[model samples]
Target: MYSKKVVIRYTATNVDQPIICQLVKKHDLDFNILKAQILPRREGVIVVELSGSKENFDKGIRFLKEKGLTVEPVSKNVSQNNDKCVHCGACTAFCPTDALYLERQSMKVLFDAEKCNGCELCVLACPPRAMEVNIF
Candidate 1:
């Protein structure tokens, strides 16, 4: 099985559609909603961790595009600027994936890149602007 982290953005017109549901029922993909801002009758975004076979994953993404949803892959270029970071643990509080964590022994901020889904919440939560995301 393969897994992908992706961001889906849709306008108010598409808000009520069962686009994500179709991925599971029709394409046999499993999706976990990581973060969502599905405001009623407003443009919103959702971050999901989708897991399935390669073919099912591709087909599900294609279906989303066909339904006029803007599907973008989670950028793999999320990083923390260690030099600028103070290790205050602020970002860790908002990290849904536990990508940012404080070491138990040292209390230092540690970033695990592989676990990061690039939801970008840490970027907003960081006080010193230490967490950064670059599309790649």
Candidate 2:
């Protein structure tokens, strides 16, 4: 089995659609929704970790694309702008995945992109506008 994290974005038109459900029932994909903002009759977004055999994973991706859903890998992630950063820990507070952390002795910020869940909390929480999300 294999797994990959990805983000899915869809407009209000797709809010009532059960695309994710179809991916599981029809394509035999296992999905873990890490973060979601699904409002009624509005734009919806979900960050998920998809797991399955290689063939099932590919089929699941194709199904999402065919349904007009924007599917992107989570490689595009949060990054700190060194010039604007103050080494403060504000952004770290909102980071649910521990992607951003503070160095104990140095009192500096540290980031691990691989652990990122693409929650986008750090972008809004950054006081110095140092944290930015790189969307694909």
**Residue lDDT tens for model 2, 1-136:** 9888888988888878999999999988888988788888888888899999999999999999888888887656668788899988998888888888999998889888878866678888988889876543
Model 1: how far is 66 from its true place, Å?
Answer: 0.3
Candidate 1 TM-score versus the reference: 0.62
After superposing candidate 2, which stretches have Cα over 4 Å from the reference? 84-136
TM-score of every model? 0.62, 0.63
lDDT of 1 by residue, 39-116 (tens): 788887888899999999999999998988999877566888989999999998899889999999998999998888
Q: List the residue pairs that clash in candidate 2.
A: none
What TM-score does structure 2 among the candidates reach? Answer: 0.63
- Span of ten consecutive residues with least summed lDDT in model 2: 127-136
> lDDT of each prediction vs. the true structure?
0.87, 0.84
